[model samples]
Target: MDKKEDKHKVAEEPMEHTLDCMSRLETMSDEEWNEFFSDKNSMSDCSFLLGYKEAKLRKEAIKPNAEKAWQHFHTSYIVPETTRRHMGIWIYPLATIAAILAIVFILKFVHLNSSDIDVSRPFMAFTADHAPQLITITEDGSRPNIIEGRQQRDGILINDKEADFTHASFAKKMIRSIATPRGKSYKIILNDGTMVLLNAESKLIFPTSFVGKQRNVRLIGEAYFKVKHDTAHPFIVQTEKVNTRVLGTEFNLRAYPTSDTHVTLISGSVIVCNRSNNKAIKLCPGQDATLLGNKDFDITTVDTDYYVQWKDGYFYFDDLPLVEVMKELGRWYNVDIEICDNSLLSYRLHFIAERQASIDQVVENLNGFSYLSATRQGQKIIISKKMHLKSD
Candidate 1:
């Protein structure tokens, strides 16, 4: 699917309304069911079809003994007396028995060992460890950790298969993470041996371990991932609106609070997916995935050094506007940024500086570069739009 198709799907109906409808229908009384069945609508067409088909089988059921008698009555009887037709006839009941027998046969003997049971079971579990988990399975065959136990129990059991992450699904594990504010950084290692360093205000969701044929994780905000390579297992990451899939590679995905999607690949191949449209595009070494809110998502080949320099101590920029540069500053320094004018938002600045120094040093570097001046007011930094021009 394309971007336009994804937008169309989102605009087709009110998501809130759909969710409310589903909630109401999840449990309905006899009166409520009758009211629903009486109404004809294209909206309810899918649900109605399911219910109607199931109800039909119920109505077709007949007694087993009656069905046997019906089969015997149909034996090759040519005598007029035996075959005589009557208004109140044995054939009617006999036919019903035969119909029921056929229906039962079809239900019991047919559709065995098929991939027909795709159902969702709605339930939850609470445990002391590994409570919040996010399990995902990739096309290339990787699994996510669900909960610790696939069942409920009073005592702890380590040897049970239910306690294993490899045997669970995302729905079962519910792996999740909490976001921290600016000036804070944390590191965690996943069950797959992959390491993730989360920047301030970033959250990630992943299985504690792999389960199925593939590995998948979800992230919110800025984080650097060093994915462990497994030729037999593929790794994937999902963000708010896109997906990044890779096999044994290192990449940094930055879906910040202020910017659109900006995925910088350091080394290794990655695939970005847009789930709404079922579309995906791959990126190579020294490439970036740029998703623009006002434009189509695109990929640009660039210097990976400038994109991932934050993982080190330095902040690097290449033809990057000042507005973007300040956004990073606010996050790294744990300060608020305020511009005097939006027109200066287009001012482009390119430089490299260590993040350890105070904000004054950063501001001084910009001030010394040109006559452009700035001042600090509380947590905000106000900058000048009007600049002195120097000419030959």
Candidate 2:
């Protein structure tokens, strides 16, 4: 034979030996196996076997049909003598790895095929004319299936079979938004067990699953959060003007685009800061922080219950201004408010009214206590100072 042919023949010998050794693993005596592993020349071959075992264990842990898939692979692919002889024993482990990967792909394919559609896509889409009361938006901006969540005592009940947000594949960095339109509210339990009460005319943008160093969510309008504490990963709430950082705490944040952003600490501690100015204020229980514009933050001691009372089915106002009260009412009742008399804006009111009450009922209740009357014009409500009749 030529020199090149001899070189090729020599290279094939070690691969043949390795494959021969691997195929005999089941039948080999313990002493023979030990001797094979102990041999310095067989170190590379033994390493391949150990790596394959590790991969097999991992597949078994995550995939229920891993063993069955392996058996099928062995029968169809590994038992073929032509493939083994041509590819050689050194390639045997690689072939097995490929087979395992194929099993994973098949399993994923089956899972996707079994479902009606991909629920991992975004929630329902909203337009200027049409807005869903409550919807979730996916990462890619696609609206997926609209799940009608049922309200529970502690949280909302979403169909668990629709999507598993906590799965590792879904936990990767992906943006999602859950929103509530006017006259509606929603409660949700996140993958990390954090409970959030979303108020009307509010939207929260978060990851379907939080990955990386920090768990973060962006909020518009208002929400009351019962954050899940993880010392290793800090939870962050980002608004238009401020970011609230907490390890684990109960707090309320209101950040309407047209109004000032407010943060009220209910329990534990939080660091509220503006990214624009880097001005941060640490809030203790019973303290409230308001971000005025993008430059100034006002922190003061306030009644925490008054700020978060909307989540408890009551609109509890303590000396809140009439304009502010109307704004809150309008949001819940899905009405546009126009104050006819500017003097009535200065009227301060204190009352606890059920949120479920109609706008007419609320307006009537207010007129009984204050010198103002509200008139409904279609979806708009006009409030003015009540004109008294002169003595006839």
Number of the predicted model whose lDDT against the real structure is largest: 2
lDDT of 2 by residue, 51-116 (tens): 443444455544445445434432322212212111232323333333333333333454422122
Q: Write one digit per residue (lDDT tens) for candidate 1, span 1-392.
A: 99978864654454334334444543767566445434545244433333333444445543235434323422311111112111342222323222223333343443331112211211111001222223222222334333332443222122212122233334344454434446555565666668787775676766655678788887888888888898787887888778788888888898764457778888888888875675778888888888765235688888888867776878898877666677677776656665554334446778789878788888877777563566666555666643533110
For all predicted structures, in order, the TM-scores are 0.54, 0.61
lDDT of 2 at 323: 64
Task: Name the 10 consecutive residues with the lowest summed lDDT in model 2.
Answer: 118-127
Question: In model 2, which regions exceed 4 Å deviation?
Answer: 1-136, 149-171, 389-392
TM-score, candidate 2, is 0.61
